[model samples]
Target chain A: MNKRTVLWTAIVLALLALLVLGCVFFGLFEKSVVAKDVDQPLSPEQMKTLAVRGAYVAVAADCYACHTAKGGAPWAGGLPFTTPFGTIYATNISPDKEHGIGNWTRAEFHRAVRDGVGKGDTHLYPAMPYASYRLMTAEDVDAVYAYLMSRPPMKVANKPNDLNFPFNIRRVLTFWNLVNLPADMPPLDAARLEIWNRGRYVVDALGHCGECHTPRNIMQGMKASEYLKGAVLEGVVAPDITKDGLARMGFDPVLLPAFMKSGISAQGAMTNQMFEVVHFSTQYMTGEDLAALSAYLFDLDKLPDKPASPTQPKPVAVAPELATAARGNYLALCSGCHGIEGQGIPHVVVPLSTNASLRLASARNLIHTVLNGIPGQHFPGLERMQPMPGFKDQLDDRQVADLANWLRAEWGGETPSAKAEDVAAIRRDE
Target chain B: MTIALKKLSLTVNGKAVDPVDVPDTMMMQDFLYEYLNLTGARMGCGQGICHACTVIVENDDGTLAEMRTCITGAHWFEGRKVRTIEGHAKRDASGAITQLSPVQQAFIEHFSFQCGYCTPGFVTGATVLLDELKRQPVARADLERAISEALDKHICRCTGYVRYYEAVRDVILNTPGLIKA
Candidate 1:
């Protein structure tokens, strides 16, 4: 009786081990991402059509902005992305046989983009925004691949990432995927309008706006609840694009795409890092798709209550000495381009009264922008904003602090608390 | 709309002008043309993109900076010293031009200005470059680049940049101690 019982127990343990190994191999019955057919060599006409479609898809996905380094060949990939951990340089994706994805099979490429897994099952860092890209259809991603592969092959080597310890470990990213990547794109809300559903997909899958706009959790994964609520990057806040956030910035659904296409409006000019977005992605998007994006941002994110107008901050009283000095300084320095009343000149300067930079809780962006003047941007059309001269050379830290204090207190309803030391710290680039 | 007014006083052409109330928003270019009757600093692009309206502001550090008067209010120069194009030449007691400055002479000899509208900014910019060179000389190889950078912000509709640039180059080559060995 004892021998039979031991043999049965051994048999059960063997079956359990096999089941575990099978699950590991099959990834829990998940379909093989690359098993489907790769397109055969296309005819001249087919290649032309595919390439054109792929170019559009690439623009929609914003592949050019992140992949290409400044002044580097398009898609040659040396752009460095700074994170809390360290700087992660983009990989060369050109069809260069030695240094790029020329050797990768369609399956490998699809799996890398769709699942954030590189060749040999290596986990890729979230810097690639695969969590969002996974929502993209295989056809769209493959179209981008085809277009990128057709581009001139650049032998540019991918720079090694300068990430800090623990983050340098690639295996750590698997946990990031587990927590961040949704199991499946949430089932389409049938109850919503068709355009609304399309807009949701446009924003989440193609745009991936949340990657930068959403605040990251402790793990550095985007906090889904705060989707597009805005987060600060490179010193400036990527202002909230949530329904109410957009409203406060004076953008309704209809005006959203217009602002995007034009890059300048009464609200603010998109000539900052946002210029890069409009330059590559949204500018080329179809009007319908842009409308879809706006629809999703403004309507899908509607608040349950308090759709009231963004309450203006009551002007806080500044110290008489500081107020007088700052007002005079503003008249002499800033009033020329930005109107005497902060009304701003059209076709040249954005109105300071409605600017999002002045209304932020921290004056980091305001200080940075004032210290480092924004270069006048030229859009695709006859659109341009005249450059605002930085007064850093003309004014000292005390003066900048005072100006910031005045801008905040007068316009932002914030108290005058910007100290000379704060401006000095930011000026020192701390 | 009634314009705000501010009392402005500044040293123009090395003379301390009497304090006078001006429209708070009056640009320095307008102040030069309207208040002082010194109209040599022409306003090319009132938005300040073109440097034809540049005026020299002597900083506290003794470094001369070319500030655009088209976008800078007259009040900006309060308690500060400034020089317009008229300040460059030696004037007689009768207010007649007696001696042209080296930069002005170089421009005339090179025939740098056909319309003569942009000549003032060129003079101001070249003077600023000369002032900068006097303080800290540039390497001989860097002299051309320095000159190019100094006048790069200006525009000439007549397209006479080559002659003007060459004239500035001749001045740098002819001047002493401005070029490092």
Candidate 2:
């Protein structure tokens, strides 16, 4: 209670208060990124072409898949994305003046997409995939803007996002982005072919194939060590598309372009979300672009190929009921294209007998392929395969189980069979 | 810059509702689920390949035809008599099921559906096939082909074609007038 001690305590408290206030003031006063508008009036033809090119860029980005909700207006948002933090609804990018990006300037839109900075210095959560979009070329961004601006505006409002505690703090995203965004992306090798370089840019940068296919660390950042080896997405495995993985799956490098275009290969078909990606994004890509993508993918480091097929099963006679059902089902459902002896019409229908899907250790892929018929994507310069219709409704659980088992027994060398309960479980999980 | 909204009116599942304003681009699938609250027609593929959003439309020729609602627009269905999966089962005023239609009953008996995403489409398609067959009965020899042709376009993801076919066959054979002995 002495005067000297009391005076000293008061002075210390004042200094501490000033220090805290100074930090807050400095942080709050930090300047935001300035919008750099490149807007210019374009001739009608230029506008049209720019918009058209932008449409392609948007497709390559697969923006519609996340931006649009199931049965909701395209680009009007409302797609709920679930994260460890919470659900974040996509923002409406429609041209509506009030609710969408209609009022946004080119600079504002660009910054929002590339830098994850929204209007008025607001930080957009990473769920927007700005990390991938950040790699988009300026021309691509301009084209996308042109395309979006040309669309008929929808007046739908953006849904508010729901996130948990500290994660909800939008400012916290800056730190997360700083820590996670890949910092060492190498410059494209000038020695590579132009087409190959283009493919690399699209696949590794804009397309962000690793975002889904590569495993994530505990911090939710993509595991760079794993690369695109394979990862679980929404419980279903997004299989390795690496050269080694492809070779093991019996994927011929020559047929990769075709596979990318239509989502079908000698092995089997892409189902579920991969189907959506092919339908919405890759299928629409130009032939040259697809070739480039395939080239880039094929160039990846691969594991040494084994002399013998690991999944190939020893020839064995299947149960009579299963064999009979498979034969009958084949006649009714698959014979038109796959043929009587499971010899698929060359260059048309993919063969079932030697298909890799039937020989996987886990019957999940087989079940998925059988349940969800392989629909072909249209590609220029390729004979479009007729889409395989799903027999999920027409074939009961027992029939599917039998047919699947028969397929493995008949064609897949030394493959295990699937049970009815397995079929039921796959169906239920879906 | 808004897309024009049109007034759409259709007789759905035996009820004729007053015209309601709907977007010109609104798919018939959205019309049934969003506006009419008929969620039976689940959307599988947004495209027409899956046939999971199929509904029965009574043709002017007095034949029942299945339509893919996901690809078709709500405006396309204006003035049409559309029967959804909800219409197949007889319901009291409160919408409690009073009776299951022949196809519904057969489905339950044969365990024809798994996940049941495509059941509505199948039921509607089968109902139409049955109605058409009743108009002109198929001989026993041709029964299998007739069923195949009728239901072949439909896609079932659960790969339940065998049971669905068996159930539909059961209905055709057991029904008094569907098949010629």
Candidate 3:
């Protein structure tokens, strides 16, 4: 062969050899890391402890929210979560030897739970919230794994995710994780109190409150600038929790913990999605934790000034027939709980006449509450009370309107009365 | 007409009990509430999205775990052992009755429940989480995640998710090294 040909051939072979060596080196390195991380045998006590921590982790991570199809076994998967792109069904993570992650190794489980990588190098969708989970510490991940491993074996198989075209490729998740997920712990602000820091850590990491409350970009990433100012999820609006007085309920930060725990805001009662969250999560939290959260929330400085009050529209006078019926119903049903004079059992039951929530400037709230019973709130230093029964079934539309009108005029002091049409509108909305 | 009944043996709240004849299609939730009088595990949603019906199913090796009883058939629990929230509040060494487990205490201190409908489920789930963690050294993130996971099966319509997270976090943060384990 010619010298030139031989040189070219030699260079080509050298390049090929280098590529092979690089691949092998990477493969070995990956295996070493996996071995270092995987299957670290845990003691039974340790395992049990992990299981407990795992339960808490699971709660914060909201695993069952996306997994566990409606009416299906918890963690058995098959819940169809709809996104802007398409519907995605979460996989079964239960300990079932088949149809679930039961056969997965500790490393495999960790990868799926924290890294969003599934078995056989499959990439799970971001809907799994692994991007946020990626910030979880190794010990936290291990505890979750232990807890999951200890679960009773469920045999339910996971349904395949329905994604369109290129999005369906699982390998793409590695790229997504690389771009969107954080591998290390979140940076702590030294200036903040330990409790506040702790609250921030939980909110940002395992709690992932921002995932729902913060607005998102076109790529579905959270808009860092708009963090926790509130956003919409599943057609439900998560009200801005920022101390934006104009944008939020007009209460000070001191009232936030109580509001969060009780679903009673200074401006109004918790409605829609916020109510659900209060019922599910916040009411159970400690006063100290709530206080810490409130402290952090109060410290937010970007709020706008409160808006000027608008002029009240003309009130619709209550019909005589409706007024008589309302008074009679109040005497029969409500007087037992709330005294005939509108003085509720002190501390035990909220007094209607003086209660700020009941006396809000709109009869809309009173109507809502009377029609749909208010769920109890858990304020610190207060005993938990049974929820008030809704009078929707017993009261006619006109009766509800009359009762709300009377209550607003008599107890609310300044609020306008509700009309029959207003009650009809609320009934229709429900 | 001939009547058919199935006989099974299972451990309930740490005690072994001989199974009586029950319909094959009887729901585990019904069996617990009607037959065993284990009302601690509730039936918030009969379909099982809510973990109100959760119970700790003990394996043969003495290790216990949580399961939802609403959708599970009684036949599936034939040879298993189960513990409910009621079982967690047992007598201590001195034989005096104690009402609060660590999980329960954490819940109460935190004021975790609003309507109290989902509290039992959360308590049961939290107990399992605490048991698994061993030492209570949970970081803030870990604590939040732990509470979230424990509450995944239950739905509360009162307090926003904040209080539940706080209750569990309080227990972990207060208890040294529990979250780390």
What are the iRMS values of all candidates?
1.1, 14.1, 18.5
Best by DockQ: 1
Sort by lDDT, best first: what order? 1, 2, 3
Please give each candidate's TM-score.
0.87, 0.56, 0.46
**Model 3: DockQ against the native?**
0.01
Two-way lDDT contest, 2 vs 3, winner:
2
> What lDDT, from 0 to 1, does candidate 2 have?
0.75
Model 2 ranges off by over 4 Å: A1-49, A82-86, A162-168, A300-340, A344-350, A354-356, A359-362, A369-430, B1-181
* Sliding window of 10 residues with minimal summed lDDT for model 1 chain A: A301-310
Whole-model lDDT per candidate: 0.82, 0.75, 0.66
Top TM-score: which candidate number? 1
Model 3 agreement with the true structure over A1-430: per-residue lDDT tens digits: 9999999999999999887656543332222112354667677888888898787666555565566776788778887877766778878888888888877877887777666667777667888876677666678778888888888777887777778776776654544444455545657777776767666655666666777878887778777788787675653345466656222334555566677678653344455545555655566656666666666666642222342343222334555776566655675456545655666654335556544444444556567667777666554345443356577865777788777777665555444466778777776753
Could you tell me how far off, in angstroms, the CA of residue B153 lies in candidate 2 after the best superposition?
8.1
Candidate that would win on lDDT: 1
Docking class of 3: incorrect
- Alpha-carbon shift of residue A114 in model 3 (angstroms): 2.4
Candidate 2 per-residue lDDT over residues A149-249, each given as its tens digit: 89988889988889999887787666556656653235778777777677777787667787887778887877778887877676466777676766656
